[model samples]
Target: MVRISEFQIKDVVNVADGKKLGNISDIDINLQTGKIEAIIISGTGKILSLFGKEEETVIPWKNILKIGEDVILVRFNEKNEFHIQEEE
Candidate 1:
């Protein structure tokens, strides 16, 4: 029984590339099923960002490998990912 607040503090690390995808900003859930559909990781301002906008990576629930105390391990592929960029 994990709380959603706990998830926001953990860092999301990709096992494939060992990239820190940032912390979780939001979650997508299936209202009908009462299950998580995806995890949204909002990127902090990087030194070099695309169009000066930060990116939000949406990782499917299936991609989540393990949920640890301090970090969440995920199997992420850069080429095949759903990203939602924040428009300023």
Candidate 2:
């Protein structure tokens, strides 16, 4: 079994655009069901800091295609669009 800590070190990549979405910074979990809801990626950029904007990329668990040894492959869908928004 793979531990959640293992995911923190693996790189997350998008198969649709071949974009490196960075590593897993955090995860959303459903306590009731004991299931992962999404993977959270921390944003990076100089401009983003200047604007006081810190957004995170949230990839739904359903979008994950495969979990490899070094990388996690994810598929992009309308419901899983990558975006930068203000962190709440």
Candidate 3:
């Protein structure tokens, strides 16, 4: 188990395709199980916001590719294919 404080918000996340997803804004946890559940990311740019109006994206833990000292890399599911979800 790792402390969430070890990571920072607004850190960039990436995919295998080298596509920039966004920055991590928050993490979602399952209160019932007391387990880390998802990673929330805010959109990286303004163009995406104009189309989708994304506030943030909740990505499941299973999708995480790697967790580095300063950044987190993740892969989102096909069902929730968000180019970028921004935080307001």
In candidate 2, how many Å is residue 26 off?
Answer: 0.5
Candidate 2 TM-score over all chains jointly? 0.80
- Evaluate model 2: give its lDDT: 0.83
Clashes of 1: 0
lDDT of 1 by residue, 1-88 (tens): 9999999999999999898989999999999999999999987774364567777899999999999999999999978987887865
| Model 2 residue 56 lDDT score | 76
**TM-score (C-alpha, index-matched) for candidate 1:** 0.86
lDDT (10s digit) by residue, model 3, range 1-88: 6765666543656575666666666878889998778777765455544555555667888888788776778876647754444444
Best by TM-score: 1
Runs of candidate 1 exceeding 4 Å displacement: 46-52
Q: For model 2, how does the per-residue alpha-carbon lDDT over 1-88 read when each residue is reduced to its tens digit?
A: 9887999999999898898888888898999999999888877743435657676788889989999999999986535377556633
Every model's TM-score: 0.86, 0.80, 0.63
